[model samples]
Target: MTNMTFSEQIWYGLFKPSKYKELVESRKSRSVLYILVILLVLGLVTFVVPTAAIITGFGGMNKLFSETMAPVAYDGNQLTIEEPFRMNVADTVFILDSTYYTVPDKELERDGTYIAVGSKNVRMTTIIGGEKWMDNITPIEQVLAPGFSNDSLVDMVPAIYVSLFLCYLIMCLLYFVKYGFLALILSFIINSMNKQMEIGLSFGQVYMVCFYGMSLGMLLTNFNIAMGLISPMLVSTVTVFVSMNFITMAMVSMRKGNQV
Candidate 1:
C-alpha cells in the first residue's frame, strides 16, 4: 500500500470519486488506523457544536448564580427565593406544603430532580443539576448554593471534557456498527448497478465506500444541526440519503470512466 497521508485520503474521500478505485485496490492491506482516525474525526465534529452550546449555557448560569443567588430568605420549614432561580448546579430553591404560593413542584418534577411526597405530591422539593433532588424538607431549610460554588463550577471543566470524550468514543463505535449495517443493505444495490455496467464492488468494498460516504454525511448533518436547519430526528434519514448519493456519484463516475 502507498503511504497516503490522511489529508490526501480526505481529499479523495470528499472530492475525487475516481480515487475510490485506489481505496478498493488497497482495501485488503488496511489496518485499524483509517477507521480509528475517521471515526474520531466524525464523532468530534458531530458533537463539538452541541457540547460547546451546553458549556456556554453552563458558564452563563454560573455567572448568573454567582451574581444573583444572594439574599436568600428562610422561614420555619419554608424558603422564599428571589427571582432568577438557578435550577441546575444548585439546590437553592425550595417548596413548602403549607404555603399558598407553592413552589414549582410540577415543572421541576418534569424537567429536574424532585422528590414526591404523599399521594398528593405536595411537598418541599429541591432542584439540583436540573433534577429534583430532595423532597419533604424540614423547617430549617438553608437555601445555600452548595454545588453551585465557584470551586465546584471550576471542577466541572475537566469533568465536562472527560465526559464528552467518553461520549464521543462510544458514539464512534455506534456509528461504525450503524454504518456497517446500512452499507450491507446498500451493497445489494451497488452489486446490481455494477453488474449492469460490467463493473462492480464486493460487499466489503461497498462497506468501505459507505464508511467514507458517511463521513461526509456526518459532517453535513452536524453542520445542519448546528445551524438549526434540521432536527436530530432527521439525522438518520439524511445521513443515509447523503451516503447513497455519494456512492451513486462515485459509481456514475466509474461507469463513465469505463466507457471512455
Candidate 2:
C-alpha cells in the first residue's frame, strides 16, 4: 500500500461499511439518533397541528372522519378525502402525480397547474376550470389534489413545508445508515404483505415487523411523545413467542420454497 495521509485513507474507507454491532451501539452515532428525534417531532407536530387547526377551523372535520369516514372501507385512491383533519396529507389537495414527497424535500406544485397569489400571508396558488385557487401548504400526503380546504398547506404556512423537507431527508438518510442491505430486503418483503408490520416478525421478516410496528405507532402517536416511541416496542414483547418456534418453521418454509 502506498503511503497516504490519514484524511486520504479515511475518505477512501468511508464508503465501506464498518462492523454492524459496533456502529449500532456507538454513542458517536448520535447524528442518526438526533435525526430520528427531529423527524418524529416534525411528523408528529405537522400531523397534530393541522389536525388541531382543521378541527378548530372546520370543527367537525376530525369528527366527520373518525366518526363517519373511517367506518367506510378505505379504497385509498378511489376515495377523495376532503376532510379538514387531513389538510396536511399530500395529494389530498392540490394535484401531484408523485406517490409521496421525499420527506424533507416535498415539492408542492409548480407553474400554472398549481399557483399561489395574494397576501393572506400565502405564497402558492393554482388555476383550474377558470377558477383560481391557492395552495402552498405542502401535504404530508398529496393525493386528492385540486381542492382547497381549511387545512390548506398554508396554515402554519412556511414552517411546515420548509422544515418538513429538511426533516424528511435526514430521516431517509438515517434510515439507510441504520438499515443495511439485509434490512432493506426484509423491508421490501414486509412492504409486500400489508400496510404495516408488528414487532414479533422474523429477523428474515423484519420488514413486516417494522412496518406494522410503525403503522400501529402512527395511530397512537397522539399520545405523549416519549410514550409514542416506546409504543412500537410493544411488538418486541412478542419476539419471544416468535423465536420459540420460528426456526423450525422457517426451515420448513424454505424447503417448501425450494420445492417450488
Best by lDDT: 1
Q: Clashing pairs in model 1?
A: 77-139, 112-130, 112-131, 112-132, 113-131, 113-132, 113-133, 114-132
- lDDT per prediction? 0.57, 0.35
Local accuracy of candidate 2 as per-residue lDDT tens digits, 190-232: 4443233222333433332332223222323423332345654
TM-score of model 2 vs. true structure: 0.23
**Per-residue CA lDDT of candidate 1, range 1-260, in tens?**
47676678777776566667666657454524566776676666666555566547757535533553443343334434444233332112223222333344454644433432221223456455566556664323333332323344444656656765776777789777876676677777787887797766676776666666666776676667545676766875877687777787777767776410
Tell me the deviation in Å of residue 68 in model 1.
7.8
Model 2 alpha-carbon drift over 4 Å, by segment: 1-156, 181-232, 239-251, 256-260
Which one wins on TM-score? 1
